[model samples]
Target chain A: MSGNILEVSGLTKTVGGGKKIVDGLSFDMKKGEILGLLGPNGAGKTTTIRMIVGLMSKTDGSVTINGRDLDEQGKACRANIGAIVENPTFYEYMSGYKNLKLWGRMAGGSVTEERISEVVSLVKLEDAIKDKVKKYSLGMKQRLGVAQAILHRPSLLILDEPTNGLDPKGIRELRDYLRELADEGISTLVSSHLLSEMQLMCDRVVIMEKGKVIDISDLSSLNAYGDKDQVAVSISVKKGQGEAAKTAVSVLEEVTVASHETENELLLDMGRDRIPELNRVLVKAGIDVFGIESKRTSLEEKFLQLTSGKADKEAN
Target chain B: MFALLHNEWSKLWNKKQPWIFIGILIVISIGTAFLYTAFDTLEGAGTEGDGENWEVTLELENEQYAQTIAESDDEWEREFAQDRIEENEALLAAGVDPNETNNAVFLNEMIYVGTAFITLFAVILASTIVSSEQDKGTLKHLFVRPYERWQFLVAKFITVILFAAVMLVTVTAVQYLMGTIMFGTGSFSTPVVEYGMGGVITTTVAEVFPQKIGLYFLNMLMFVVISFSISILFKSQTLAVGIGIFILFGTNILQGFAPLLQDYFWYPYVFLPHMTLQSYVVTDEFIPGVGLGFSLAVLAVYAVLFLGAATAFFQKRDLV
Candidate 1:
């Protein structure tokens, strides 16, 4: 058997007479890995998650979960998936414990009381589990949502914007829990517009734009310590020497001036081997360079660059 | 499937509306019993001769019905007076007090009032079952489970029926307790005379009461299906309930006009006039030329169509 838990290929969704909401999207999720579906607004991230969980119909393509085709073996395929699509909602009048029991029963099979308590404690909701959900804060409700999703120990747990309304501590707790679940070999697919959170939580990210996959990158590879062919270096010079430094860096043939960090700082994209040459050119132009450091591309920067580049290409 | 049904059952009992409805039913039923007891006592004190001699009361009531039957121009009025005369004569001969405050009589009255409220509550419950889940956005949690879409819909449909059954039993128990407490338990073997088109149909309270309850549920099933279909077709609980209640109360008005419309070929096929399943039990025919078999068959067809449409729509529509 392949180690992958979910394999989606050539997935397409068209709505309202041919407006393609999701177009030719394909990706795979491995066991014990957290795959982030990173996208801007209206990037079909939610649409893809909805289709994977079978909440929305896909116009074309096949979704196979743990080697079972979703179309032919839908019951078996969906049995392995637990999802919280968009925002998780429960019967507000019911206590959190009752809500969990209610959904646990709906999940089929006899869910023991121990399992219910286990999930409650796993989400750190033991104290608040007896309280009605209407009294729960957004963060507590989010924790309850995650607890319910993982109750059955589904092979693939899909969360769409699970951290949307969480406070910092709640987000951290969720991240820790997801990591712990991954340690036990449960795959998770989380979709989010929060790029930084995705950076901290996901192992690999599939970035999408305009109903299509733009890029897929390992989170470690996007970090500064990971291998990259080129790096953007930020040079800090004197406050008033910024304009002169820009002109000197622009005159260089190999390096591209990426952005100005501030009046005193200049950012440029070039190889590490040419940093000394660029420094010599800046010094020759009478610009005082105080400090030079290589800046790693953040997930946010990469996301903006990739999506904006696609938007530019489309416009062209 | 059992698990899903159990989950739905939990969701329903946890809500405030069902309990509130039960509370209201209990209050109204007990209050009505108290009022009936008080009125009967006062009327007995006011009429000295009639209270002592029911035979004299029956003779007077029979004479009045005979006068009405002779003077009435309307055919239905004459038939109604003639039936009342026969019913009163039978009660006089059997030594039964028509005005007695007994458990059987209270039960009969409660069922009459309870069935109306039960129908309203059943419609409200069925109309909101699916739509309320959609409104609260809990359907996503449910649909993601291993069950098929049709299974979810069927679970909800079965839950509504179970809810109706629960409500029926609750009403029966509450009314039974209150009736026994207020008025002594009357003889279940006592025969109550029902005025039929052919003549007086006599049956014991035990036999007739259950049949009325059965017919009540059957009538409720028709409304439940209609409201369930409306719930699936529309996401707004207000719209579903409003249309359901409108159809429910509107049918009374439609029945009034049914005689004029019965000449039309499609009159028997129309579901509203046929919803009066009680008419089949008490009278031979509610609508002219429409018997109990015909009404039941028409309602059965409507029930199937409503459920079929609901399941089909719910299966095909995207849960967005």
Candidate 2:
């Protein structure tokens, strides 16, 4: 009765030559929480979700659902979860409704006729619900994927890249549906490489880099996280005074010269507030300041810097 | 387990392949009956007694067969004549009409023939039943449910066995209908002729067919088990199906090699020779003392081994 619907601790997966593709991932989801797993490609989000849902075996560590250990009570543990691993594929020869009934039957036969129609129309699939899945477009298939994941009203919903191949409207509708489900006290774990989407959909986000959780943070300062940790504020004094600019900024306590981008421009690794401090030193040194320009504020660039480790250390 | 079985059964009937398989079976059953009727008059005229004087006609055919056996030097032709002569003498001694072809006779003969098609379709069905789910990317969805991996597999195994049984029942029913339409229904107790190690044997359809169909059904169950195991264990669907069909037809080819290989100590243990367990009904022994019990035992051992490997592999396999 921890009230955490899903708990994963030190979960690891190793491939050939003992390479840990997913290493030491520990996270927990509370009741009615919308937790997003945010990582770049190859961050092991799918691998972790697969292990939690029993699609793949874990080489080490444990996953517990609804206070039930996965090893001791796997069926009971899985009964609490509904997942769409990677992309959802259905029995294409069957109608969408029949496919739902098939999945509903597999969930210990508790899904009712009313629940079937409720999920169908909840996903707005009532129009083509009787048609074969083969005829449904990618967007329709995505919607049906949502329908099947919620058919049994599982307490834990795991969707790996559920927004893949979805339009903007579809994505928005899915976000709204997830919020509605969250209002009903069903915890959901959604993984995506898209940071903005995660920011919009998740109540909390766990950022991963290189098969490990680099940082866990709320939505407010995540944009700030990208900026502060990046190699920002590349300064260009006089063409000849680049050397002097480096010499003058050496007086500062926490400055490190990041890179020598050009003969005249010295890329400085320091916080944004210290830009004026270095400017004062350069002016005192009697060097003509050509210009002090920080790198452009693109989130993806900052994210790359974040995953590449510079932003992480700054945040820590 | 029942819920899993219901899910699998629903998914199976939702496809088109099983329906097409049963459709072809009905057409073949009806078509073969009409084809047999086209040559019925020729066969009646050859005996010179039609259907009513079947006992007298057997005597005339036996006299003609004796002359043919004496004049023929080719081994097959001589054996054929000698065999028919023994069959006629056995039927006459038993007072059973040899020329009575009716619903019971048609059913007895055609049930095994239709099951050959059943065996083929069942092998194909079992081969693709699991691997097709893998190919279609729906397998991972099943893995996430509130059931063990082995439960899904066992459900599929039972489904295929059920499918093969349903095909057998349906094919027999359709063949019986066609038989009644063409030749009329005869006594289920009508005597039929069979060749055995001790010469021709006389038995009734009622006395013989239960054993035949029962043995056939058991043998067909082994076929389904083998193919279903191979389907789950192997990665490639086409290769799984190819090996399944190869094993199905390969049993007959192995029958040709049985006599040569019988001297080997391991020959009896190999499952191929035992695949035709129905053959043991007429002959008391396949060779000297090997019989239905030995074949059944060998098949049971093999079925356990095949399914053991499949279940072990399926339980540990990580669906990527």
| Best model per TM-score | 1
Candidates, DockQ: 0.78, 0.73
| Residue range A14-113, candidate 1, lDDT tens digits | 9998999899999998898999998877889999998898888899999989999988988888888878887789899999999988878866665678
| lDDT of candidate model 2 versus the reference | 0.85
Per-residue accuracy of model 1 over B1-320 as CA lDDT, tens digit each: 88888888888899999899888877777777777788878877754555458778877878988999889899999998887788888887766666665788678756777768878998999889899889889988888888888887888889888878877887787777878898888887776766554566677788788888888789889888888898888777888899889998888899789769988999899899888787666787776678888889999988888888878888777888
TM-score of 1: 0.90
TM score of chain A per candidate:
0.85, 0.74
DockQ value for model 1? 0.78
User: All candidates: CA RMSD in angstroms?
Assistant: 3.5, 5.3
Off by over 4 Å in 2: A223-302, A309-316, B69-77, B196-198
Worst 10 residues of 1 chain A by lDDT: A307-316
Could you tell me the lDDT of residue A2 within candidate 2? Answer: 95
Instruction: Report the CA-based lDDT of candidate 1 relative to the real structure.
Output: 0.84
